[model samples]
Target: MIVADGLEKTFWHRPNAKGVLGSFRALFSGVGSAKKAVESVSFAIEEGEFVGYLGPNGAGKSTTIKMLVGILHPSAGSVEVAGMSPQLQRREVAKKIGVVFGQRTQLWWDLPVRDSFEILQAMYQVDEKQYALAMERYDDLLELGSFINTPVRKLSLGQRMRADLAAALLHDPAILFLDEPTIGLDVVAKERIRGFLKEINRVERKTILLTTHDMDDIAELCQRIIVINHGKLVMDGSLSALREQIGLPTTCTVQFASTPQIQQIRGIERIETNGMQVQVFYDKRTISTPVILDEISKWGDPLDITLAEPEIEELIRRIY
Candidate 1:
């Protein structure tokens, strides 16, 4: 459903001084410096696939998304969505994709949320029957009926985001480009958006290309992850496969009845402890979870145990 072949975006940033006068002078003077935000990054996403495009701040994730969505033209290579070039056939491609940018809303600020939906329906030239069904389906899925009459400017961040999601799907686009749809949202709000996304992808067979800093979002929604770093494609694989490829240690935290001395174990890399709790970082690829659990049990009477994947930052660092 989506393809990017050697896609690249190069931006020329002007040298600006600290204050207003210096910035004004520099704009008319020396040559600007060229920075490649996204360079030769390419990947193909299949129909009905949920893939995470993950990267750190200034990692060119947004640059790549913009090119794919036709918001920004690429400096090199090409991007196609639904077999149409987004840059060349932007209008035609727009009908095949839905986009949600978290910090920015496509809804009219002063108008009621219902009005924005109506406007988009007309712009898309949607049939009245299709419009009604879309509204009904999203109202049920997003629980947007409560604030449908409220002006978009009056809605909270969570409500505005939910409204944005509803607005994006009004035309029933086949692909979804979700750029941090859960940013600044509480856990409940995030979960609600995630559930809606999961349903749309599963029931409607929508292809999704997601870019987010949140690891929980990736874990819950995406089956495949395409990792990018420093304007280059670094890693791309299923979540489990990525873990195995990176070989990051699984963290096991155990609350013990007493501080227990942990001896060297084959798979266990390191161990740290507080008063009654022990934290161990171990490579599960080398040894089984059962083996590690058994060794921990032998240390002391365990009260509680929680196993977690390495932090996403740590995982990204492994690729670098």
Candidate 2:
């Protein structure tokens, strides 16, 4: 559904200066350095595939998305969204894609939510039957009826998000670009959006590219991930493939009734002791939990046990 080859974007930054005249001079001279925000990035996404595009700040993720949506033209290489260049045929591409940014809303703030949908219906030239059908389906799936008449600016963050999602999908685009869609949302709100996204991708077969800082979002919603760092693609594969490649280090925190002698185990590594608890790091690929628990039982009576996987940030740091 999407293809990018050697895609790149560069920006010329204004020069820094001490005084007002110096600033004016710098601006006129265009003396600032040129920076490559996105460099030679290449990837292909198939229809109905949910891929997570992940990276830290200044990692070219937004740049790539903008290029894909025709908000910004690439400095080099080519991009084809559903077989047409977004730069050359933006209107056509826009008709095939829906974009949502967490920090921005496409809806008119002063308009009632219902009015916004009506406006979109005219803008997209949606027929009456299709518009009614879209509203019916969205009301059923997104619960839009609860605040359909409320002004968009008056809705809660979660409600606003749902309304925006509904607005984006009103045209029934073939692809969806969600940039930090779940950021700053409560757990319940996050889950609601996640469930909606999963259903849309599964039943509607919409190709989704989700960019998020929350690892849980990626883990739960995306089947595959494309990790980028320093303007380069570091990893791209199935979630399971990444876990296997990274060893999915599982940390077991076992609290005993008393501190036990720290002993070497066959499959555990990086074993450490802290007061009443013993922390053991082991690769799930090499050790089963039952065996590890059995070894712990041999040393002392356990008070509590918990296991955790490495955080997404730690995983990215490891890759870069």
Candidate 3:
């Protein structure tokens, strides 16, 4: 439903001169440097797909999202959303997409949450029946009824986020652009938001593009992931594909009653032991978890154990 072909965005950085007159002269002079925020990035997102757009700080994830959403025009190449040019047909594209920024709110601060919905309803030209139905669905999913009458300024972060999600989907847009929708939210709040998004993507079939630093968000919500670094597309595929590409080891930390004799295991990459705790790292593709557990059991009596898959951060770090 979205395509970016050779998309690029460059921002100019101009430094002020020492004196006022020099500063004015610098403004007219070509004395600034160009920084490419996104470079030759290309990708296609199919309909009803939830894709995670990931990168570290200043990696151009936001820049790409802006171009796709028509907030910023790319310096090179082309973009299409739902078969229409977002740059040329911005108004029409706006009708087909919804956007939510974690650090910003589209709702009025002093107005009640209900007022914001009514305002957006009028702005989107939604009919009364459709509006009622949307509200009913959102209320059921988001539980907005608890704070519908409260002023937006008085609501908690979780409440505000839930309300914002409801407001964004009230128009029944075909796509959703979520930029760190779970950032700064508590664990409970984040889980709630994730659950709501999962339902929306499954039942409503809303194509979503999410940009987040949280690996759990990517793991739980996205089926595909697009990783970028230094303004260039580095990786694009499923999480399993990414792990395979990076060749990161799966680790199992075990707390035994005491230190036991460690032996050579074919698939085991390495082992670290500190007092009662021992951590074994291995390639999961080469050996199954049950086999690993059985091998470790022969070493000693286990008191506690925890298994962890390869982390997204580790993959991105290796890519960088």
Candidate that scores best on lDDT: 3
Model 2 pairs whose backbones collide? none
Model 3 spans with C-alpha error above 4 angstroms? 18-20, 253-261, 274-278, 285-306
Clashing pairs in 3: none
Per-residue C-alpha lDDT of model 1 across residues 135-173, encoded as one tens digit per residue: 999999999999999999999899999999999999999
Candidate 2 TM-score to native:
0.88
Which ten contiguous residues of candidate 2 have the minimum total lDDT?
311-320
For each candidate, give its TM-score against the true structure: 0.88, 0.88, 0.91
List the pairs of residues colliding in candidate 1: none
Name the candidate, 1 or 3, with the larger TM-score value. Answer: 3
lDDT of 2 by residue, 244-273 (tens): 788758899999998786678997777888
Which 10-residue window in model 1 sums to the lowest lDDT? 311-320
Candidate RMSDs in order: 3.1, 2.8, 2.3
Count steric clashes of candidate 3: 0
TM-score of 3: 0.91
Per-residue error for 142 in candidate 1, Å, reads: 0.7
